[model samples]
Target: MHDSCSSPQTCTKEQVVASAAPERTRPEEGHPLLEPVSAGEVRAEHVLRDTFGFAAFRPWQEEAIEAVLHGPGRVLVVAPTGGGKSLTYQVPALCLEGTTIVISPLVALMEDQCRALAARGIPATFLASTIEQGERNERERGLLAGAYKLVYLAPERLASEWLVNQLARIDVSLLAIDEAHCIAHWGHDFRPDYLRIGDLVARLKPKRVLACTATATPDVRREILERLGFTQGDYAEVLRGFARPNLHLHALRLQPCDQIADAQVVRAEV
Candidate 1:
């Protein structure tokens, strides 16, 4: 990944076009959230209650949001599955100017998130191969027109010259990378396409970048930062303790068939 970043010869014309700062419509004319806020002013709590219908932030969520809303905007969040990782970036997306580009790996997850956001009257959309061509075209048009506050994209889509060019034409307020662990070569779920995300970051230069993952070891965490072009001391790290008091672990040493029988008995008891 460092090799690609250092060699300008490896960059394509499309990447250069994507990197060049294009003349964009003033953000004020776009999303209402694009309006500038005074320094030290925080709208995250309000957005949380009003937009997401949440009374308060989960542990470490507010800190992650603050990092994005304030200075040293690049962030890496490692939290458990139910630790409210989405809120860290989602709140800031509504607070900041321009669209938030979310790179999600699963089609189901993207569709579910977009649907949920739409139900809340938030302008969010996703680009995936499962959608019909007409719908995809319409979404692409909406993206270029700055009609959405949040847009979800698959990492593979970043390789498309046309899509990259279209994204370049818009203002990206924040870049949220979900399942960021995949970017680490040593991670259990590593995907080759994820490596291209580093290149995308270089091209888009979003105002802020937030990488979130439920699981990442120290080594995997280091790789994620390096691959995303975040150097030490340059970004904020939000690491949440992985303990869940409500969840209990029980071990049983038994044959596969006996284990199934025991599970059925436990289910019946419950």
Candidate 2:
């Protein structure tokens, strides 16, 4: 994985891993992370420390979190992999009043994040086809009861009228769209179900929405904003530079027949 340092603070890979570890005690009802700040107030640093056990924010993470927590509430975050893009919304999710709905494209990614949050003593769950109906029902009950801070679902799951109706009943504090580039037709990865997310937002009327992606060009970003029903000046945008000094790229030119010989020679040398 590539290491990214967009902020002047310079965060190391060790620091990032250490922050994500579930070593800190979970924030309780009286903890600072659980305390609600007034409108236009920013308590992200508190959440970063008390919940994630991080000493600082990476690049635009704090700004993005503040936007969702106190600003326009519509945000688009474009940061490279390992740039703490998840924390932009996750931090705000902890401070918000209701459950945060995350629409992710990959089940494994959702499962991994849910597990990580659970390990940190944060309530999180996901809806996936691999789960049995009994478990799904139980999870749904938990969702309605506000037993979770974050609830993940696949983009395709929004197509279900029953599920959408059920979500409408709950107070959705935030709606986060992971891999948001999929909403753009010209993007490298496009999912048709993502196109319906704007409709879902209108139907559910979540108080806030955040779209995050690791790769998106200027045009693709504009398309994503449009797809999510965001007009110019209606949303906040946080973009971290994509320069990875620690990651290097090299290219070698060889004929098709020479490829195996080159690999074998390299392996022998190693």
Provide the overall lDDT of each model, using Cα atoms, as 2-decimal numbers.
0.77, 0.77
Q: Candidate 2: TM-score?
A: 0.78
Per-residue C-alpha lDDT of model 2 across residues 110-207, encoded as one tens digit per residue: 99999999988999999987789999999999999999999999988888898899899998888999999999998999999999898997677665
Sliding window of 10 residues with minimal summed lDDT for model 2? 25-34
Q: Which portions of model 1 miss their true places by more than 4 Å? A: 1-42, 250-270
- Supply candidate 2's per-residue lDDT for 10: 25
Q: Model 2: runs farther than 4 Å from truth?
A: 1-42, 250-270
lDDT (Cα, 0-100) at 235 in candidate 1: 57
> How close is each model in CA RMSD to the real structure?
10.4, 10.9
lDDT of 1 by residue, 200-227 (tens): 8778766578999998998998899888
